[model samples]
Target: MLPFRFIHAADLHLDSPFAGMSGLTDRVRKHLQQSTFIALDRMVQLAVREKVDFVVISGDVYDSSNTSLRAQLRFMEALEMLDREHIPVFIIHGNHDPLDSPRLAVTLPPLVHVFGPVPESVTVVRRRDGQEVSVITGMSYLTSKVKENISLRYNKKAGASELFHIGLLHANVDGNQEHETYAPCSKKDLNTAGYHYWALGHIHSRRTLQESPYIVYPGNIQGRNIRETGPKGCYLVDVDETGAVAMDFRELDTVRWFDMEVSIGDCRHPEDLRLNVERLLTDISESYTTGFSMVRIRITGRGSIHRELEDGFILEDLLIDLRRKVDNQAGTVGFAGCVWVESFCLSSGAEIQLETLLQEDSFIGELLRLAETELAGDIGSDSVIGHALRPLMDQPEIRLLLTGSTREEQREWLRRAMELTALLLLDDQEAGGASA
Candidate 1:
């Protein structure tokens, strides 16, 4: 039997809105819309090129229940491309797009097979060489949340003749702090399931659980925002006749994610920051295919140039100019355009002073202690306060005051505002003395 090779991917989040974005140019926003679809098309193309035995999409085919009809149709069309190549596609719906009412009604490609909500079994796919290959057994989430552990549903053992046994699941194994604990299970739970490979989903970052059984999360095909940065893509698994699995990560995202931290510690002027940004972008452009890549530049560090970086309009203009240059030079070769700057924040070295306050006996220090006590007592309420005061705390003028203000003024207005704001918002009066 020919050994089985398959492509595993999840969390497509198709047509999801870029909710936390601002300052994106019209062109960039347009490109973001096509990103998921582009990545899906790329996945199908990769599958066709590789001539894999089958493709398994663990879960999350769409972004939400309110996904657009256009997105649904486009997705099916991409699947049809795989169908044309005679490649069978297996999919399971996750919490985001459960197999129920309200989702876009559409027909899947003939070659596509979707697992139902309940756990079920599928026979091992064999090769023409007469060897029994892998058996893929899986289940989808019926509702938005499956509170109970679902690993028990996949407890069946694989047949002896099968070279590999795979379990496809949409779950948050253990308790991932960054994600909801849906379908929680332990590594031991999956190991006991007796599967050679466990393809998992829900968490957006790529991860490898246990190599012996090969449990993994391939991450999302395309990143939707700054939080989901880095190279987003799928995993290619090559299984040998002895059930030895070799895996490699393949970049399927047409739009690459970049979260670059540009330090301005030595920058003497705003132009210096501008030039530094240009240098960084130029360096990135050199290494990547321009139009197809996206970059989020964050300006960091304490420097004299921090004050000048305060003008959002001017900084944005500089970024736009840089993007224009990059786009003009390399837009056609599938480079979408120039870099898209997400956000810029400035900090003054006030944190050191704040740290000292935590151990002091001064009035400000005592107030800071009290705030911390309150914060510990009820974190959720204090979080709301922090969110409300974040604008004032983040203001460039306020950050500059921490250093530039005279001793008398610092002891009066500056220190008082800091302490009061920290107590009321951050639940830590010590933050007023914190370095920006």
Candidate 2:
């Protein structure tokens, strides 16, 4: 068997809308709206450039349960491009786009092979002499909710050691908490399946469970939310004549998502703080080249300007000004890209010398010590503060804004409380000194 290569891509989520974002400019929104399709085009371009023997899309090619005509047409168009190059595309429908879906009726080109609900095997041959290159075994989702361990259904046929066997599946292995446990199976179950490689989907984070047999998830082609941060794309895999497989990741995301933290701990004035943030934004903008960059800047750490930031109007104005400065259009410099601040979260505290203040043995020091003691111990959910917070935390929106979701979060909440108390006491002392 001669060495051959193929592209393994999954979770395309075609025509998917960006989530958890609002107040987007017309141009940015339009660019993001078309990003998924752009990523698909990039994937096709990559496969053609790499001159892979074939392409395998593990699952979720479309975002909707009832697939849109536009998505169907665009998908067909991409496949047609590969078809023109005499490249074959193997696909398995995932939970998002099950075989039972009432999608737009469109006939795929002959080069495209879609797996059905039942397990099937395909022998891909060399285009030149029709010599068998590999055997691909796969199954598609018939319904959206398939809780059964579908790995149980796949059994490797005896014989044919020379032919490389690849298993294409759209499943949640060993119960990934991030997504529903559809077509769930254990790592051991897949390892025992006897295939050389398992191309998996469902979870949109790339991971390799085992290296020897290569049980892998290629993640998604594009990121559609803040949660799906970083470079998103597919894997280019090569299987040698000796059956040694090598995998390389190729980034295809048109729009990138990032969570950036800018500390204002040293800034003494508003202008200094603004410059600090601007420098950070500039640095981030220069880093990404693909298209647009969406960033959520978390302004954190103790600073002199914390009091001013606590005033709602001030933070709002700063956000408006920062957006204009960062997201403004820059001419095509390739890597120099447009960066938009999706949201600004102020987690910074007021700058105060806590240890010196605590040495004074005052009421403020007592308050600080008390908070420290409480934080050192259990949060005491049965106590007065916790009881008061229970009702407020029950509301989803309020809980989202609240920090204390877990024990670690409770500690952070206590820390922030101590900082706030210390700041307020210092301000009171300053006011008294001025009056005297």
Candidate 3:
């Protein structure tokens, strides 16, 4: 039996910038760029700590189609650490890093083996106590887009003398909606391949399809954005001679991604909003091991403060204050900053006197009718009256003015419409107040 273990990891989108993201501090940007190397370093450390026999990187080692020489060198240097520890490394070219690229010219460590695009496997012979163990495998990408099922290519069984059979593939594996449908295949396709373990990649989230044959995705070593939030890392697998497998998830990410939603429904003033934000940050910072963290806070829900929060600079200031609080509480947790506020709704209980306005056969009634009709068609449409009148109506401040008991309730609907209008016009300010 081969008395050794292996680490499987993939999708290291190194040095990829969050281009469309806004409201980020300069420190956050720098940390993101440096996180790639940090993750790589952690992987190497894990391999050395466990004294694993080999490490397999499924694909997407670099973020660019044309990788820089500097990045290539740094990557090789990190791998050299593993080579120095007398451990071998196996690499497969993913969709991002397809074979036949001449940009990578750095001399790799002798212990490292990089598989080409063709589906071929090299046997690794390990000797322990005068006994030899042979591991057979096949891997490759063939083309940028391997539309036809590639799992069928590995149907042939391994030799009887082979101690372990493994297949390293960069495939979509039965059409995952969350990922690009690259090399698609069914579970039956993999089961019939006769491989004891299939190290799969392409998807950014870690998943274990089956434990019997051990089909797994180590996920991306690090999360790149808000969409890819949660604990991101690699997998450590220990397979015995009898084909019994044991797997454990090991976190290797230096930077973490978190998405937080703070509802301002009860926030009547800017200070209330600030207090809510501070409380949320405090909770998040306490939950994480790393004092330094990056957060994307989404201000949501209907509230009176929605109009004040629409101001770009004012919202930015709120984020700054939240960051300051987190920094003060836990000096190590770095706030990457906040995300764009999706929408702030004003649910104040106040109604527009449409009956009074229409009693005089005024334009306000006609405008209200048009808005109601458009809203009926599609309440989300930009042409809704609330959206149309935002620019003309000006009420920057929020006030508690009520007359009729039910009048307040009626005005709330008008406020909501005004809120929607403000969003449509991109006013980033409050609309006119409703009169009971």
The lDDT for every candidate, in the order shown, is 0.75, 0.84, 0.68
Error of model 2, residue 225, in angstroms: 1.6
Return whichever of 1 and 3 wins on lDDT.
1
| Total colliding residue pairs, candidate 2 | 0
- The TM-scores of all predictions, comma-separated, are 0.79, 0.88, 0.75
Candidate 2's TM-score:
0.88
Name model 1 segments beyond 4 Å from true: 103-107, 127-131, 157-161, 310-317, 323-337, 348-436
Best by lDDT: 2
Rank the models by TM-score, top first: 2, 1, 3
Superposed model 2: Cα runs more than 4 Å off: 325-336, 353-384, 391-415, 425-436
* Clashing pairs for predicted structure model 2, backbone only: none
The residue-by-residue lDDT of candidate 1 on 206-323, one tens digit each, is: 9998899888999999988776877788998898868788888988886766888788777787788888877877776566553366677767765766445555676777866766
Candidate 3, residue 194: Cα displacement in angstroms equals 1.5
| Per-residue lDDT of candidate 2, residues 1-436 (tens digit) | 6788899999999988776578776666767888899899999999999888899999899996878788889999999999998899999999999999997667888889999999988888765566788889899999888889888888775566678889999998888888888998998998888889999988898899888789999899998888788899999999998889999999999888899888878878877777887787788778885467888888898887888887666657777876665446532332237777788777788778877776767898887877777777775667545665788878988878665367766777778778887877788989999999
Q: Report lDDT (Cα) of residue 215, candidate 1.
A: 88
